[model samples]
Target: MTTQRTETTTLWRPTGPEELALVAASGWRAWPPRLPEQPIFYPVLNEDYAIRIARDWNVPASGVGYVTRFEVETEFLARYPVRRAGGETILELWVPAEELDEFNRHLVGEIQVVREYR
Candidate 1:
């Protein structure tokens, strides 16, 4: 018998450019840990959701925001539940603060900025 390798899928995360800078500082391999006050890392399912957060919340609050795209192993994604918030089209993956390192291990490649709001 043989075990098959799980394929990876793409996901988007919206954050301030400062946060993205932190990711780059890590050598483009993983995300920085969530802030002390942040309990979860929300990686959304669609670009629309990411863009909205970047544009509406991050930009308004910080003057700059970015939408980042990356790939995650499908097998790892099974460990958590996806959640919906704000509206029907808004969906996100809830990565607990403790599980973030494991989540980072599943990232397939560099996290790239797909869009930016300033």
Candidate 2:
């Protein structure tokens, strides 16, 4: 008998350079810790959702935003199912702030910049 292995890959996030710095300063390997008042870290599932947030929310507040791509272990993603909100293909996953370190451990490689929003 052969067992099939699940190979899920690719996750994305959008943020301003300042925010990206937080991740970069940590060696471009993982997301940074959340602020005390912050409760969850959201990594969207699709480029569109990430782009929208980067363009709509991030740019307005920070004057610029970026869309980043990364990979995560499939099994880790299975732990958090995709979520949709208000009919958008949000493809969002909410990782509790406290669990971010564990989540980062699943990243397959360096985070990359796919595009920028301004």
Candidate 3:
């Protein structure tokens, strides 16, 4: 007998940097069908981090860069697979592939905090 398998993946895009941070702030829902509430501190802190990066880098942000709007483009296994609870989705915004070097410069002053990323 043969078995079929499918992989799930979610694609999220923030309006800008702050929006990206906001989505990351939303803690990973460990439980499926019922995502429990988690600490808001990390999200808040991440928002702060994104904002500080914006200012220091002169990214020209109007308000908080928390992810305001996004949509799922495609999925790997599921029709629209969501992010794994507390997974790498959050990191995507931290180190955008487009502007990797620029983000690094903004992150230089934050070596201590970035230890988590490393």
Candidate 4:
């Protein structure tokens, strides 16, 4: 069987040239002992805030059941929504396996938060 490779655009960046929001990511991908890409990101803030974020992006929480604290830079990011760095309503969503391929077809990258601790 072939695993349907898809680009999961889990990060939702709202309108405007918003400042990047820091993100830390750990997931159930290849090389379980480590991460594949830069485990840090600064995408715009979405809706889910913390709990929802953990569900979609964090490795510990991606499975059938688990809890992880992924948002470490919330206070800092909330500072500049209208200033130099605008923002978005950060949210973590699970797209249907089929749409994953075209979810962020034109997007660039994932929303990976910085390395953090629970």
Candidate 5:
């Protein structure tokens, strides 16, 4: 008998201190719910884009920023289309706020803090 390996898609997210705290509170297993004004939970496709956001955008806003890496089951990710928010390399998976809980359920492993900026 052969064992089948599960496919997973790696994703990166740039976040502030507050959000990182919440992620930690979940034991690094899930993301917190989006705020009222926040309509989407977007995880970028590349680490470079995540680094840029963490260093340039998030750090300035919160004094510190973090770049987190995580994996989601590729089959579940198929439901959401990749979105380009800016330049060509700015690719992301846009999971609607309402579907975030379901999205979290598809996470393949714990979210990791790959890099930090201050």
Candidate 6:
């Protein structure tokens, strides 16, 4: 008998309360579609970056924030290049809004809330 292992890359997303609610409504299995004004869905490469956005940006804007962690097939992630938005630690995978449905299909498992800021 042979066993096969699936490789996955961990990603984190910083979300506000409203967005988190939609994710919950999906049963934590998928992210909601981006609004008309949201052109892209960027998931951070590291927890520190995600924490920074959730704590500093989301909290101030919405009074609450959450850091959600999830995994995606490593092979699928190779299609998108890692974008450095600022400093060395600021890395993200920018998934186009039009492709988000395909992105969600590549998720390895249910999204989980790893941290929260108020």
- What RMSD does each model have against the real structure? 2.4, 3.0, 15.7, 15.8, 1.0, 0.8
lDDT of 1 at 107: 94
lDDT of each: 0.90, 0.86, 0.27, 0.31, 0.96, 0.96
TM-score of each: 0.92, 0.89, 0.20, 0.26, 0.96, 0.97
lDDT of 5 at 79: 97
Please give, for residues 1-118, the per-residue lDDT of candidate 2 as tens digits: 9997657588889888777998888778988888898798888888988899999999999999899999999887888878886466877888899899999888877988899877
In model 4, the Cα lDDT at residue 89 comes to 40
Position 4, candidate 3: lDDT: 55
Candidate 6 per-residue lDDT over residues 3-29, each given as its tens digit: 987899999999999999999999998
Q: Which one wins by lDDT: 1 or 2?
A: 1
lDDT per residue as tens, model 4, 23-70:
222121111111234242333334344434344444343332222222
Locate the minimum summed-lDDT window of 10 residues in model 2: 81-90
28-110 per-residue lDDT for model 3 (tens digits): 21111212442111211233333444444324444432222122112311221232334343323222233323322222111
Q: Model 2 RMSD to the real structure?
A: 3.0
Candidate 2, residue 100: Cα displacement in angstroms equals 0.3
- In lDDT terms, how accurate is model 5? 0.96
lDDT of 2: 0.86
Q: Give the runs in model 1 whose Cα sits over 4 Å from its true position.
A: 1-6
What is the clash tally of candidate 6?
0
Candidate 4 segments whose C-alpha is farther than 4 A from its true place: 1-48, 51-94
Give the distance in Å from residue 100's predicted Cα in candidate 4 to where it truly belongs. Answer: 0.4
